[model samples]
Target: MSLVEINFDGIVGPSHNYAGLSLGNIASASHKGDTSYPRAAALQGVAKMRGNLARLGVQGFLLPLPRPNHALAEALAYDGTEDRALRAAPWSASSMWTANAATVSPAPDTRDGKCHLTPANLVTMLHRAQEWPDTKRMLEVAFGNGDHFAVHDIAPVTFGDEGAANHMRFCEGHGTAGVEVFVFGRPGGKFPARQHEQSFRLIARRHGLDPARCVFIEQNPAAIEAGAFHNDVVSVANERVLFTHAEAFADQQGAYDAIRAAFPALEVVEVPSDAVSLEEAIRTYLFNAQLLTLPDGSMALIVPEECRESAAVWKYCEAMMASNGPIREVIPVDVRQSMANGGGPACLRLRVVCDPATVDPRFLLDEAKADLLDQVISEHWPEQIDPADLWSEALTTQVVAARTALLAALAITELD
Candidate 1:
């Protein structure tokens, strides 16, 4: 059986705004209160999806979670009357970064012969914490094929589950059994490690992964202090290739050795510290680039346009491509709207490896459907959104109407 890894990217929402809600994200904090172009952001995301479908031939899409999170405000007893509550609600369009959506264990690795997914609690950050409920509903509706998929609620909030951003898998192919690596951060640093060790262990156990095939590693404190808020900031993996920076983990050699022990065929590509400093990696979001295995069995790096803009990063990418490495091509995508808010190409997607036939058709995308979605975004999405505009009753109504129209167009009434 041939299995493919499908990238389910989140459609950027009309509520996309730069409220600077992500505390440790340097870009988010630096660009606080800046005006955001929601229409452009959504279109950019759609365009990126189109590029993937056209170039890689394997692309899936997920709708944005309902935003301005009114339920959270009501839970906090703010009643939406005061501007303080409205603003404090975070109105987070952060759901566009679906890497934090869930941790998925494909059928090949699970004991039950069914794909398993656990929605992330995202409890460490206030804005992200509200995502689980809606995220759970979305997953349930999209992956409702009970014979092939199992969706579970997030682990306890105390466990601090940040989802796939802290998880990665490696194997010979998408259909083969793979080793699941869960990277967790300890709480002794200047910046909080959003993923907890307990949470990682709980997820591995819940997924019923074989003990020998599961590995747990710690993220480097220095990296966290230097603004590597999540493991993806420093490392990323696809199939048997692990693309990472030199200072990404606490015990880099040990982590690699452990992975090698489990999967001896693993290929480790470490970009040396001297070539690209951790600061440059974070600034350019080099590790956040999607390392994809193309239809012809070659690999390509789908990176944010910011990578090309950075002199050192772009030079490194060019060298990597020229060196005849595993990555055959470097495709630059324009997601500057998401980049400013601290997300890039990899951040905008969730990877699920399975037979396409097993997933709901509504969740998949093709060139024609992508074109229709792009048209919907262009016609209905708001042009600009300011942090202060989130409280207006008119804006709330507009957001609702836009999402309702999109759901109707997609024939997905469950979310509506």
Candidate 2:
């Protein structure tokens, strides 16, 4: 199978904003500042998501963490057995990442060097994932045993950190089928900030990459605060295009047109606001970039509620037709709980592996449907009907219920 690498977003324990307020044993809330829902909900969400993926037959992957912080440690530690087949991508996690070169700054004198903390953790995760037979066997074949690490050895200061650089390295290793990174710049995780264009260009050059393939997306209104347009023509020269969608840009189509004109070869797609509400635009954009289908016929979809709304669920279904364009599929997820800090679906979910060929689909069955009828018969009609007969009827009812709920969720959740 062509290597499938997806970033595992919701894989970690439920991630809650703990800017303030606390819920019993769970840490205090940040960013969004809500402390009502227990962290258990997020944890359950992760488990549910994993089961969904596992059932889908997904295995062998890479996880590029937003930040390899203590929170990640806690999340992973919660689920012991640190399997090593999966590699933890360090590009976005390591603090030493600078846009100009791969090397760490501040003269690199201290042990706790800003970049050290996350890289160490990332490497640990990578090692753990690699230890597993599936991930180990596959990765060794792809990058050549340990040869992948050498790509990261180059001290390019351009990409911000080892995590992000490693991500770039993996992309580069893929040759024609390499990765195309779309860095979502906005208010919440505004690492590159307004200089997204400059940052991406510099990072691209440092990595011996063509800027044309890199995409820079500005998704936050606050990042564009003061109404300053950060779109630059120079950056567009490098294929580092900007993204402006109704759900993300306050000026939606205007931003889209601007980006479109800037990079003629770069195709700019319209994002439905209802597909990704203003509050969840950042995550929505990430979902589009990371999980959505690539031009090649494979899906990297991140299906949030927004996709169903503006684009229409049927349209999304149509879009996923696996034609000459890209393989597409809706990622069934809910982000209503995570929208407090201006993030929607993407913010809450992370993509660990993206190669579509690796998806395994065994978990999409309707277990809930089985439970409902069983409950009714056991409670009232226990001796009246044979168990097998009841099961037959229940299975039929369950299928209908599952399909209806899925369609309903898609219809109700959208970018608006």
Candidate 3:
């Protein structure tokens, strides 16, 4: 089975300035504390996609960690290294879980917002759990299938003290046998905004992932402007897939161009863009793996009411759809806010695994299946990611299973 493990956020920090304030333990760019509604909605969007994948017989699901800062803090405090080296780890450990509320972090104020430790913990549990039949086996399978590396909007780790330790625990938990970290180190101990393209190639080789199948594509944290990593960059498709986006309507032509050049051999289909803006339409284009043209002529796109007449979107969609075979179905989704924060439906979902075996037979055939599964995936993105063909087959599967058992036990005890 072919799977794509996606990490949200090409760089750390929420991109949308308008996204409600965060209300977790750590403070953020926004005046509002951690656990903001917008952030929750973003996570919800990704979660929704996982549920959709389950229905599609696609075993993959998004493996999401805590917020960027939250995760960064975790790693900083516990990567079994010094503070400087830990901080240099490729990604940050941000999260919406308020450390203050859970007594996880000694924030200046804990009562200011609602907080929960479960989301981040669950993320860790989901990613690291092992074996099938484990309580959260579904979560592990959906998120654990990754060898070759790729990421979406993932932020770099940046924090001190307990915050750092929590993030490290999460990363370490996922750093089991098959999982490979695709992040990179920054100079002077700061996470750079530029795309860490080198990390993609490096991790692919380090983990023994197939370069012919692995891929990492994402928006560079360095520039929310147009032309970040899009214009001219390419990498070998080492046994994995990584794709990221930052509002298409913005200056991201370069980023698009890079992807086009990267996956020269994959089948790409263009569809229609009926969304309100060009960015949303284009983002749909990327996830559908239709950014570039397939051997056929049609293009695949997300059909939204607003983009019915978008010439570029329509033309590409029509071309991809019209290619050798008809274009795949047009998926409708609501991702208006994601664009503001450098994300579209694809960015929000974070695909960790794809169950090729369970996927609809139609996906394997030349024809498209008119079903909600495709729609759900196009909409939520992460709900369908699976970590492996079967959780039992993975090396870390046992660990995850153990963790799941512990969690179930703890839950039962709490209930009593």
Q: Number of clashing pairs, model 1?
A: 0
User: Considering lDDT, where higher is better, how would the candidates rank from best to worst?
Assistant: 1, 2, 3
lDDT of 2 by residue, 1-416 (tens): 23333333322111122232211111112332233232332333343345444444442212112222334445445343323211121111111111111211110211221111112111222322211222222222322323122112322233222223212211212212222343334433322232333444444444444444444444444423312112210011112222234444434555445444434444433335464343343323233232333335344444445445544443544654544433334454554333332333333332232234323211121344223322332332212111122123463344234323432432422211
By TM-score, is 1 or 3 better? 1
Q: Tell me how candidate 2 scores on lDDT.
A: 0.30
lDDT of 1 by residue, 300-373 (tens): 89888888998888889899899867987998989999999999888999999878888888889998888889
Which sections of candidate 1 miss by over 4 Å? Answer: 79-90
Question: What global local distance difference test value does model 1 have?
Answer: 0.88
Cα lDDT tens digits for candidate 3, 107-195: 11112211111111212111111111121222323222333211121122221111111111111111121222222222222222222
lDDT of 2 at 100: 14
The superposed Cα distance between candidate 1 and the true structure at residue 336, in angstroms, equals 0.3
Displacement of the residue 226 alpha carbon in candidate 3, Å: 0.9
Model 3 segments beyond 4 Å from truth? 1-55, 59-193, 210-224, 227-326, 352-416
Decoy 3 TM-score against native: 0.37
The top-ranked prediction according to TM-score is 1
Instruction: Using lDDT, give the best candidate's number.
Output: 1
TM-score of each: 0.97, 0.41, 0.37
